[model samples]
Target: MPAGPPGKHNAQAGGLGSVPALGRPERRAESLAVAGLQPFSSVDFPGRLAAVVFLQGCPWRCGYCHNPGLQSRGPGAGPRWPELRDWLARRVGRLDGVVFSGGEPSLDPALPDVLDELRAMGYALGLHTAGLAPRRLAVLLPRLDWVGLDIKAAPTDAALHDRITGRRGSVRAVRESLALLRSGSVDFECRSTVHPAWFTDADVLRLVSELSSVPRHVLQLARLPDASGTARAPIAWPSAALLAEARVIRPDLQLRAA
Candidate 1:
């Protein structure tokens, strides 16, 4: 499009200049600091060690959103990545890996630089995305070691799912991403959050059946929390009737109810 405030290259007149077209990197060997880092995590991705990165900003306004503070993109906060990079620089031998999570880390224009930096740091990479921008997955999937994709709902009807996400195009994006990643190189899993209002037994079965052929899909029964958002109350789990339906439908289904 126009220009990138003269960081490295100048866009040619009337050309798509310097944006690097989704997956390509125009420059590396320079600034590649990750925005945020959580020293260690147990629940981020199954068994591997990871650091939670809080990349700022997101496009959707799902009511079930847990990190509301990360929704808004604020003014420059003095490059958290540089310091993160320095921190990682010392832990090259100590930790397992890094996870680039966010308000939607993929949406951040600087993700490539940060990911580029992480790669240089010699740590394995993992990601958690809501599948907002499916096309970008083609680019980002190659960079990650594992992916935990939050699948909102069935692609058959957008309105039902959109009511929760508050975004019309999210279902389409999520579906497209699932289809595209069915045969990709990265190790990935698809999970749907089950809350009282958003899902019914039939709905869960439909969701699982639709994704029956996907390589590594997982169904995560999201534990609904109390008003404080910190303390969780143990409500009755998903119905055994629904569980039976899923078992009957997808023999290879991977489900965990919490």
Candidate 2:
């Protein structure tokens, strides 16, 4: 999508840039609130065996969020950062990288320092974020090896985008973040979680048309939550016609099943 000039929404209240950076004294490894950790994952970081650190807390509330438990900022019964780091330390040469997946990794103030520490230990770092923190992301970009940016909707569809995220003015922040990634040297991919319940065929086409210029844009089917709240494969898929049209708009568009 065309990267529009920043306007009032870009400066909206509660943007991550408003959060103060952690002072040196408070930049401890444990300062990162850990919701959970995946010891090893081949898929989390493309082309690498890596551990996924699931950080706690997120600003948005997407209905299709798989990590809903991570939405809260309050302390949970998850591993401590020091403990997780010690485990990663032992896998120094065994793993190719470390991925910071999260309710929103950029929301944590300690992230910049944490990235520095992991980078020094010789692990390429990756981040999974929804672009809720454009200013924070700008600071973290120089330290990242790869980033998976989650796009909820076309940048021009602010109402639809905010509705999906259950947050106001999210499109503005995501737009700025997308612009940052486009202008930077970092390798990144744009991904959107799609479900017929949430996105109609026209919605999918609009999103893909806007992302036509992105090097990699993935359309991942959104998993449904069973009665027990476990994520299961989607019962339905986007129409074949829609997928065909999407590819015509962005030939490089990738469709992934849940």
Candidate 3:
């Protein structure tokens, strides 16, 4: 029951269902390449207890990437599905659900297969994504128990967003995903990390207000220079003054240290 790097627990070594393969199982998804795994987490999925599965590969090259190491598709390619399923099999009784997070979980063409395998085992499925592809999101929506959607920038700020993401039109995909989630039956929320240098007080407030129609809209105060993920150089963020302004306009916000 100890929580540490994966070696501590093998939830699926010999259990109810056999471990699944981490390859191209889902015909609709991109592929199944795993980067890392966390056996247990209380914070990742709100109230539910669950395990965190980190998927590898991402198309976006965000400068502040926390997991820059996992961005490459070719590096971690191998038979990953079995490892994931075996690990989860070991955890069947203890954990309530699974959280698929990543360099963008939807990028994997084989994700639907992985999800189906998890569902077959009676484990609830959750996902954390940047909302890169609305079409793919539509595919995963029905199977999702909950989703933590990260909105990086506003739709209007294309140039700034493109600069931060090193990709054009990504903002549109993110926005479309947001709208899709809002209308869906799934329990979901939109969370934006307020990295001060990225946007001004006015920008953040406007963005928050725009998402007000969503049942759950959270404004996260971003922390900088944290090398744990793919974060690179430090950037200047807004002070308490801007944060306070956001608190007033945004109804529900999750503030983190910046």
Q: What is the clash count for each candidate, in the order shown?
A: 0, 0, 25
- lDDT of candidate 2 over 1-258, digit per residue (tens): 111111211222113333343333224666887766666678777788987777778879998787777788865345555555665666799999998876898888888888887887799999999998899999999999999999999879999898899998889999999999999999999998888778878898999999988879998887776899876656646877777888888887888753
Q: Model 1: runs farther than 4 Å from truth?
A: 1-36, 75-79, 223-234, 251-258
lDDT of 1 by residue, 53-170 (tens): 6566777887666555556775222234444556555667777787766667666666666676778768788878888888777788777788778777866758767987887756
lDDT of 1 at 75: 27
TM-score of each: 0.78, 0.86, 0.80
Q: How far out, in Å, is residue 37 in model 3?
A: 0.3
For model 3, residues 1-258, the per-residue Cα lDDT tens digits are: 111222222332223234554343343323477666666788778778998777777888876565666677752432256656766766788999998877788877778888988998889898988898889999998888899887777667777678778998779898889888878888887767666567777788777767767767666554445547644333444556765776677646665431
Order the numbered candidates by lDDT, best leading: 2, 3, 1
Q: What lDDT does model 3 reach?
A: 0.70
Model 1, poorest ten-residue lDDT window?
A: 1-10
Q: Is candidate 2 or 3 superior in TM-score?
A: 2
Identify the runs in model 2 with alpha carbons over 4 angstroms from their true place: 1-27, 226-233
